[model samples]
Target chain A: MSRRPPVGVLAMAGVAIGVLGLPLVGLLQRTPWSSLGATLGEAATLEALRVSAVVSLAAAAVSVMLGLPLAWVLARLPFRGRALVRAVVLLPMVLPPVVGGIALFFALGRRGLIGRALQNGFGVDTLIGTTAGAVIAAAFVAMPFFVITAEAGLRQLDPRLESAAATLGAGRWTVLRRITLPLLAPSLAAGATLSWARALGEFGATITFAGNHPGRTRTLPLAIAQANEAGQPEAAIAMSVLLIAVSLVVLVGLRHRWLAPRRRWPEPSQEIPSP
Target chain B: MSIHAEIQATVGGFAIRAAFDAPAGTCTAVVGPNGAGKTTLIHALAGLVALERGKIVLAGQVVDDPARRRRVPPERRPIALHSQHNLLFPHLSVADNVAFGPRCSGLAARAARRRAEEWLEKVGLAEAAGLRPAQLSGGQAQRAGLARAAACQPEVLLLDESLAALDAETRTDVRHLLADLSATRVLITHDPVEARLLADQLLVMETGEIVQAGAPEEVAANPRTPWTAGLLGVNLLSGRAAGTEVALDCGLALTTATPMTGPVLVAFSPAAVTLSTAEPHTSARNTWEAEVGRVQPEGDRVKVFLGPPAPCRVWVTPQAVGELGLEAGSRCWASLKATELTVRQA
Candidate 1:
């Protein structure tokens, strides 16, 4: 009842430290204290581990590359349908992970929208049971992270820099590469990290659409799910630990060491810092 | 290098209509109060904003004209702007930020960096080449911003409040730097002192329209409108002239050095007049008696407005105000030297 401990403040602090912190603490505590090396040395475990790394990295890269143009349009352009477009782009952010998987299946499955057209045009089939499918699914859930981060970065920038460049005789592509891209670096790094974390832990979407296949579409999350179903709860816990470790290393590196060092340095703070 | 433009632009809730002939190497100061569309005028000319009507001719190239179906985007225009915020790429070092303009302009990267170093050195910022904008002082950032704008070697430089964001100390130094910069410059500023120091001509605006424009001296000596008169620090008296002088119905005669023989515009600054409470015995040329209606304290001086016997204004220092023991409603006499009086036919 003290004035310092407002009800809402206590509730928020309780939720932040209790709910989010407990799982992270338990995962670290139960991470196979004795058999970590043996679990890591298993062929299946290592394969799942490699798949998670490659697929997540690939998905993060693809999301960053593709999300950039969409983010630019949303953040920079003043088109009539911009509001609607932004809402549509943000759908994956709020959509249930399972629902997102179902939607992905409808678009990229063997009998789905793009699957039929791609097959007819190029005599190709959807790699739904392969490694690429895992990447596609991971990208699906994670793409919104990159787009949202990049769009926010773009929104904070002054388009006048590009305009000034244009007046200096630079074309659109030149301005985008030299001005917008460099300016968006910190946001881009954060976005890439977020998407990577999301992709590494993708389960529902990868299972429903990519169809879990060992050495192919099956990722670390699927391995963990399968291990738990087979009554190996400890192994599931271990794989989850591995996944969380990867996320922590990557996310912390990006946010602290890679993206934030130069920013925290105090240099040319003017009459006003950026509003 | 030269630009002649007549453009009318309407954006959202505001519209700007401006026309000016900027000869190469002449910096024109477009001076106005806040929200008077000075920035919009520069943007339209730079092709940053589209014109609703009229043409923009830069070095004989038709940059934009809605009627002619010609619109060159800003990137294609031979111009550069030092933005108000400096907009120094926070991620890049001072050298890199300056190099960006030239590199974007298609100069080879190494060549662009070399040019950037040269410009940075010119702007007195070569020592800070490796430093980020956050590391530079406000004045250093301002210099770097100018160096970056000049690195592109723009034919027309539009400075949109480039120095306004700097602190007073930094702003004073940048003002001198801008004065020495030789380019086809257009400065959009709220400071009359800036306009006087940097521009060869002044264009004054109010509510997005040009109210008056001319050489600073001309505008100061003879302003046609109330807004321009206020801007140029002159008291404008519009009246029908019959001979060497025009008599105000307030019963005071406003004398001019040149005999204005017909309807005319006459102006004089308060600073040019001498004030007294006595009828002068000597020939002080133009003397008038009027009741002091208001005494406005301006800096160290007081501007005393005379309501009647004849409405006129006289300026004296606070020391003089106390020495004369002047007050509102106190009867006073004022004088204008005949030579200081300026007249022009309206």
Candidate 2:
């Protein structure tokens, strides 16, 4: 409210700033910018970037398809076990990615419960070590980002607008399609962007559930781990820098996209003389 | 279309039982203090809230009948609601927001836009068609909301303090706009003045029951409850009435123009009471020696509170106040014509 914050708050804010900025500073210091091009020019680095783009985009798409309805249910619908449902939906956000990957393996891997059933009954192509499997693993750890953001958006939605729409003769589905979803565009965009970023950085889950099969399942994060283990630290650092840069650009771009509608739409513009 | 509703429902811990009717083309106003179930009644009509008992018949069709296990959802009902907060869709352009209803009703997009523009021009907001609801001032936004609702052409229009949220200037403008609407209307408000200005029929509620319902002037002149009296800003007295004379509970007897027997409520405006330092020999039907309980300035006039701790109030010019030398402890005679007093069954 005031120009200057209190001394205690300023000191705490400085500590918070350090906590967030120190890691980026460390990354920059170790970036190996001079050899960044040569390091990233390796076939493995380009393959990982390609696989990361494919798998993360797929994961992001899948997360939105599944997360939106769940978000709406959590935010708007009143039903028994809603709290439990929400908790289960958000569990992956808190659970270690490795644990989530293991859980996904149990649920979908060959010889696992549903996986065994599908293999026996339908001779279905297995998800294990496949590109699709990598996408599933990434989504398992990332969908909560989309769901939580979208749920917050749905919660902020004013019910009166929907009521006004209904009274105007919109059926339930029409109101959702015409009014609710259009209004929730900002939140959906932000959520999908977060999900995509999280999926791009997914490593523990992809490595455990999808396996680190180069070109098939080795996303950028998994590739970084492999590069470090294979004694190519410079390549790992270069890829890490690339990943950070790409994510920064995406985040900045998405922020503009997310905020543009609200600002450019000029809601509540300065009170003009009434016409 | 006529709206006949007898609603009996309970929300949370409050019990609501109210019944009223508005014939086609008549504007019926439901007015009461806050939490008196005015909005609940509107919700019931809109089918937003279900009735535990009774039935709602709109245009001779039974929209809600709990006994028959039939209920029409809000969207299916031919009713629209407008509240104080002009809840136009914040994201949509003004034209799109207005076009939304007609489009939903199976109109072609072009036709819907035409209908929206027509209503916009009618509400004097045609120039604002391209603007978002947020771009408009409060008054402009409310006018857009009105156009949006009217464009739906619902059988009944439910207004829940629709004009009450605007600034006085905006309220007057919107109120005039509301008056121009010819749909069968139900206006819910707490302002007695707005009710009188807009309503042909007035229904007064108290603790979720219709305590009074009649023509606005008749209801204002003969308010039976102190809550309504307070809202109407009138002096209300409870007493036993025998013929033209009523003995007030405060030991003051007054004669009224109306001749009614049994218990009655006697109401008169504060401006009707004249205060004098001496017992003036006038043709006033009732005169009482009263003490000035308190003196407070009311704009260009002074409101002299008369007691036994505010049995009545009198408004006189500051000059009259100065001439009469009225103050907190001043003893004075309060007089009024019998014709000014309104007596009604309590």
Candidate 3:
């Protein structure tokens, strides 16, 4: 609606665009193209990539599956200490990932609460140094994203929908599956994407819980870190390129389909009746 | 054992105690002012709210009763309620929201979807089947809601101010649809006009009590209470007319524009009449010199009802009554403006 911008506005725009675009520009410039082919051919690199994919996908699925019910409970049910329960779910989001890792290690490392029971019953000594451990750690940090977003979706849903479904003869469970879930799908998709992204980026928690084991739990991020530690800058940069390229593709596609524009339902328009 | 039931429940801070016998075909309207618990009564009857101290018995099933500890959850209740809020599901297509209950009732998925399509056609929303609720207009949404309720085909239909949200024109259409699809309908409303247009009987609620209940004509004919008269806007007559003003047999004279040949209603506002103790001559169209039959305090004003035959009434300030030393049998002159008078056809 405005006709023109002031000189200050132009200056601010220049600064903002420069700040926003600098990282992508630098990544493209710094990408080691010649070394990319050789580094990608490395068996360790391919194995690490496979491990990352499996761990991140498993973590995303677990997060969504668990977070949905937790979100519904927090948003819809009334109980004593509900606020406390909600706070517990949200703790991972606020805690530093390293602290999250330490917390995970204490619980699922050999002597932890359920860890002891698992060892006694199933003879599973610990969750550390395994692909499942990396997934558990990744899921721990990623689940909060799903819970918070899904809870917002559940909170915003009108109860009338369920009521209307009932009048048409829907029982509670039927309404939930047929009416409630589909209605909340966009939010669910958004939450799933957030969890996926978070899981893919998991470094500290995976390192602490699963350790860096090639072909087992050493994901792309761990591989890149190991390359850097070994002073193989070329290999690290090549893997970084692949990581950036793939993550960008996943992020863009998920965003375009689920997290993009038009997902935000417009507010009901109020048309003033003519007097 | 009948479809009708006694409904009692408390919601928020309000309590509802009503014995409603919704006959097989008649539409019973629960008409009351705002906050009169009409909707609560409807919800209680629909099993939406738990009873603090009553029961809803329908077709021999004690759906809800606090004392007997018999309560059917809303989902299990045989009755259907089209909620006042036009609650269409925003995410699902129009067809899916309608199909919800049947599928929930254990119908196969295909059968449920078919029933949903049939109801959509019935509500004239078949064209919008693929669209979400956010796509429908107000009336369409309302129709969809009704379609969803009717699709279940429950024994008792409880509409809780269902038409209150629609525009005037759409309301007429929905009301027509409702009348055609009529079952044992318990309609909750605040508008007497809507009540008269839609219902065979009226249940008037005042505060938490049922002040009056009967046919609309009967209730309109002899309003047992003053609130009922005000709500129905009927000429409440308990007096006789003489000349330009009718004197209520209750000792109150009402001025009217039409000259009464015999018995008539001389209607005028309480504000139109000037009350004075002195019988001074004035240009007022009707001047009534009557002894104060009774002086009752109403808010800041006192309603003065004069003697029978010329039974006339006027409202004067409490301060004025005190200053004039007004009491029963005290002589007073009342004057009313001709422009302020209204005549009923009857």
Candidate 4:
């Protein structure tokens, strides 16, 4: 409604836009157009793409499996130290990624607490320098996003609907599967997409916890870093463009699901005849 | 199925203590003012709210008895609650929402849907089976919700102000449908007419307790509380009676035909009052000069509320109101005959 913004606000807004848009423009300008397809089609680059897809998708799956129950507990349960638990859940988002990686390394590295038990009892070694380790690292850093989004969605739902379902003979599991989850589909999709995006771009944790190895732990971001170190800036920029395109397509494809305002079911009018 | 409950529960520091029973295949209407714990009682019966100390038996099963540490979760209880606002699931079509209960009861999907269609037909919503809940009108949505609850075939059905949000025509239609349902029902409503129409027994609740319970006509004819009298459109006054002369609690005295002693409730119809601009010396034993409060028009009669020392409602014809020049804030003399007053123990 306020079509005429102040001149000062407009000037500051332009600066904010430049801050976000300039990097994309710079990346586009540095892109090597003529050999872009050749760089992307290279065997190493294709392998990195496949690895990135597998790791990020698997991380998303893990996030849902773990985050949903955590979200439900946070949204529906009341207990002492709940805030502390939520803070712990959110710690990885704000904590430095390398710090998270170092923490994971200490907890699950060879001769570490659980790692020592696995080796002694189950003949299993550390979860390091493998695609599974990369997935663990990425999921550790990205799952909080899923938990926060899904918890907020759960908070927005009407608990009375669940009660209505219960009175109509829906047990806990049936209510969750038929009513609660269906109503939460949009939030689940949004959370999964966000965590997937975060996983695809993960660098510090993956490199620190799961050492970069070609065709295994070397995802798109790790491969791009390697290409830069090897002085192939053209290949790095090409892969970077590919990553940006994939992220943009996914975000746009699911725009309506996550970006729209929340909607509640229409209820009957509240007015009643006075007693 | 019959329902017998003696519920004592505390919710948010407010305590509700009530005991009532509905015979098999009968309708019991709980009527009360706002904040009277009517909805809480309904929730307790449906097993949605825990009873701090009480027992609830539906048909013959003991659904809740906190004293014995026995409880039946709402899903396992043989009771369905049609809460205010219908609360139909927004994610499913009308038929699917109705079928949800049957599916949860272990009926196959196809069989559940057929049961849903049958209930929808009974409620006159058969054609809306495939439509979404949001697409239906308010009345249609209410009927659909009723159908959904009834489709489950619960022994006890709880309706919390089911017709309160509907228009007059829709209310009458739903009322008829409620009357036709075979399940034992416990309906919570604030409208006296609604209670009188659909219930075989009426329970009046006040301040989280059932103040009175009896046949609808019996309660209406001799209301125990002023609020109940107001709902029934009758005038009631509390007084201490000494023979035929009753001294009202509001510092007014009235003469009645029957002699009574101790504290009493004097009941009379608003039509028994005659309003005049000048004091009248007639056969009427009670006369008072009071200022008019609110003048509301009912069907063919105008209802007038008189203000303090003896505040009461009086119904008069439009012609009398015109001739007496009655309006709010005007002074008038209201008179009633001694025989018109019915004095009973308070």
For DockQ, the strongest prediction is: 2
Isolated chain A: TM-score per model? 0.87, 0.89, 0.89, 0.93
Could you list the chain B TM-scores for each candidate? 0.82, 0.87, 0.68, 0.92
Model 2 lDDT tens row, B133-250: 8778767777788788888888799887776546666677677877877789998887778889999999998899999999998877878788888777788989889888998888
Question: On residues B228-328, what C-alpha lDDT tens digit does candidate 1 reach at each position?
Answer: 77666677776767767787545567766677676776778878878787987656578877778889997677888878655556778898898777898
Every model's DockQ: 0.39, 0.58, 0.24, 0.52
lDDT (tens digit, per residue) of candidate 4 on B1-346: 8888999988788899999989998999999999899999999998888999989998888999988899999999988889887999999989999999999999999999999999888777788887788878777788888888988988788998888767777678778988988889999888889999999999999999999999998888899988999998789999899999999999999999999999999999998998999999999999999999999998788999999879899999999888988999999999999998888898
Query: Between candidates 2 and 3, which one is better according to TM-score?
Result: 2
Ordering by TM-score: 4, 2, 1, 3
lDDT of 3 by residue, B268-288 (tens): 455667878787577776676
Alpha-carbon deviation at A151 in model 3, angstroms: 0.7
TM-score of each: 0.85, 0.90, 0.78, 0.94
Best by TM-score: 4
Docking class of 2: medium
Where is model 2 more than 4 Å wrong at Cα? A1-35, A38-42, A254-271, B121-127, B166-176, B242-245, B255-262, B293-304, B315-319, B325-329
Model 3 stretches with alpha carbons more than 4 Å out: A6-20, A256-260, A263-275, B99-131, B165-174, B236-346
Indicate whether candidate 2 or candidate 3 has the larger DockQ: 2
Q: What's the C-alpha lDDT at position A137 in model 1?
A: 83
True contacts kept of each: 0.59, 0.66, 0.48, 0.73
| Highest-scoring model, lDDT | 4
